[model samples]
Target: MEDTNHKQSKFQRVLDFIERFGNKLPHPFLIFVYLAAIIIIISAIVASFDISVTHPGTGEEVVAKSLLSGEGLLFALETMLENFTGFAPLGLVLTMMLGIGVAQGVGLFDTAIKLTIEKAPRAVITYAIAFVAVMGNIASDAAAVIVPPLAAMVFYSLGRHPVAGIAAGFAGAVGGFTANLLIAGTDALLAGITTEAARAIDQDMLITPIDNYFFMATSVFLIVLLVGLVTEKVIEPRLGKYDPKYAEEGILAQKQEKVGRIEIKALRNSMIAALVYIGVILALIWPETSVLRGEGGVLVPSPFLSNIVPIIFVFFIVVSVTYGISAKTIKKSGDIPVFMASAVKDMAPYIVLVFAIAQFIAYFNWTNLSTIIAVNSADYLQSVNFVGLPLIIIFILVMGMLNQFITSGSAQWALMAPVFVPMFMLLDFHPAFTQLAYRIGDSSTALLTPLNPYLIMVLGFMKRYDKRSGLGSIISTMIPYTIALMVGWILLMIVWFLLDLPIGPGINIRLDG
Candidate 1:
């Protein structure tokens, strides 16, 4: 027992050190503020030194345009509002959430979750929770906030370690972040950045928002299996039997309620409505002369791929409203606007973060620093005879480390895409492949990061089961998932690469092929 306690203590000390370092960093919004200021200062210094690079596609000389200059300062002043409002992630995330908000506001998601949890077989409950948690990303903010606590309740009712359920939910939701059956705002956000970066290398290059859809859809199954195994075989067993002593506090101690008829009806109606909506979409895209397909029946560069977020928005709002009406949750038409407004209101923090991030990205592009770094990095890799698999492993590791300090997917990709995407393209890698590697890395460390906002909620769920649970406890439970996911996902990517499988329709690992 003493040896066991000592090993646990040592593991805890590592988490403590990680949390301490992470706490020293500013809020993500402020981090962007600091980054923007630093970029401007560095750009001025570099401009003074006359550093420049030749554009890879255009063959035009590019030089840093210091924000300290009068014209540069004026441009910043004039474009500040535009930067915030025109930011790609800002509008896309908001648009999708507006629809999702209606579904959540009307008790649609709550009913659906209850039905799923209660009806799942005892042996498969862990997989069910993990799978639902991963799919919940389609609803944006609601999933991260709603799933963990509910998962704890379900586990406690089943006489299992509730904390293990919380960990499972978190592992699938945040750690399996990029793996989803449906494309969400983050997909569109990252693809937009990838497109911008690829254009810098090849003027006519275009990347679809769902460029990684095939790979990610397959990943959802893997996340469910792997995370479910970890929860049942590793975490739950380690936790042993749950004590009633610990259960007498927080949410777990509250009275449990059965799923009502109204909720069941709501869920049933929602499913029917969702299928009809999907059928409509399929009917529109099935024919060779369908308007949804681009020229020559191509999927990529098609209107359907480009308009995915809006399509998701329409689906969520319409079906959720139908469910609300059937469930008697919505009595008046005015309720629809209220729910939509609630969703937008919930995104206040993201708006501020996007504002700062937009300024940083615009300034980075103006200064040409990212291009210069991409050229230099590509040159160094070439000199070392590095390309293909070894380079991919390095990119994944670098991104995994960075995820610890920067938890926002869009923000991290905003910083990385400008340099790494083009650099990989120079190595004959397609931008889709580069984005795929980055996504795998960014997701792998999400469960272990103190910087992740969702981890705070996960810790809260843990405390409901064990009042003294801390950041260290949560991190310790999650580190195994983080490591396992990185290795497993990377190996998957390697096999996919070796097999020369297309990551998406008309997209491959190599640009020229």
Candidate 2:
């Protein structure tokens, strides 16, 4: 027991140091602002030396442009507004949120979660919560806030360790964040940033939101199994028997809310609506002569691919409205627009962040620094013969470490995709593949990072179960999930790579083999 306490003390110290260091860092928006300024300064210095590289695709001599010069200043002044408005992710995220906002606002998502958990059989309650949590990414970050507390309540009612339930829900909701059975808002957000980055190498390249669908869809099962196993086999056993003395007064007496008939009816109606909507979409795209089909009836580079964002918007709107009507959450048609507006209002911070990111990306592209860095880095990797699984594993590990401090997936990808996407492309890896690898690393480490706000939220839930719980307790419980996820996820990626499977529809792992 002394040795175990010693190990825990050592771990606590490490977590303390991490939290302190993370607290001292600037906000993500400020980080981008500082980075944009640095890029401008670096552009001037590089241009003064006339440093250049041969463009790998065009074979043209590429020279860096000085953002500090007269012409550069004119360009910046003219493009400021255009950059913000034309930013790829801005519209995609906003549009998707319009539908999602209404669904969440109408209580569709919350009711559905309650309905699923309350109906789960006693024999599979743990697995059910794990599955729902992992699949909840379809509802965006709201899952992080909703799942853990609800899971804890269910566990308490079932005579299980509530803290263990918190761990399981968090492990799936945040740690398995990137793995979803369907294309989510995250897919749109990240794909937009990736398309902009890939432009550095191929100007016409456009990465669709579904480019990583197959890989992510498959990962959902892997994450469900991993989270369930850790929760029951590792975390629950470690937590031992629940002690009422450690819990807050009266908390142990609280009962889980039973799912009502109205909620059941609403969920059933909404599910049926969702199926009909999917059927309509398939009917539109399944025929050889369908307007959604490509010239040769191919799905790739087709109207279906290009129109996925709008499809997501309409689908959510349909399903949510059905539930809203049945649940009496939306008494009038006007409520739909109000819900969408509220959703966009919630995205105000993201909108502001995008402004800074747009300028940084525009500046990076205008200066040709992205191209220069990518080409040179690609050449170096090739020269060392480190251009395969070994290189891919290293990239995933580096991303996992980076995720510890920079917790926002979009922000980190915005900063990284410009360089890594094109660099990997030069090494014969597809942009989609690079994005897939990044998601694996990013998701696996999300719960382990003290910087993730959701972890603190989970800590709050833990304290309700055990008043003595601290950040170290939450971190220790999550450590097993993070390690297991990283290893399992990375191994999954390796197996996918070795099997030479497509990550998405018509999206190969390599540009050419």
> Which candidate ranks first by lDDT, i.e. highest?
2
Residues 1-513 of candidate 1: C-alpha lDDT, one tens digit per residue: 999999989977766777778889788788878988998899999999999988776789988778899978997999999877876667777787788889889988777766777789998999999888888876665567777777888888888888988888888888777878877767777776787677667757767667898888888888888899889888988888887676534565664467898778778888898999999999999897888899999766688877777888899887889988988888999999999898888888877777888888778777788788888888888999988899899899999998877778887887788778888887889998899999999988888877677888778778777887888788889988887888889988999989988887778888887
The global Cα lDDT (0 to 1) of model 2 is 0.90
Query: lDDT at 240 for candidate 2?
Result: 96
Worst 10 residues of 2 by lDDT: 251-260
Q: Estimate each model's TM-score.
A: 0.92, 0.97
Give the Cα-based TM-score of candidate 1 against the true structure: 0.92
Off by over 4 Å in 1: 1-13, 203-206, 249-256
- Per-candidate clashes, comma-separated: 0, 0
Tens-place lDDT digits, model 2, residues 332-411: 99999999999999889999999999889989988999999999999999999998999999999999988877888999
Number of clashing residue pairs, candidate 2: 0
Off by over 4 Å in 2: 1-7
Candidate 1 colliding pairs = none
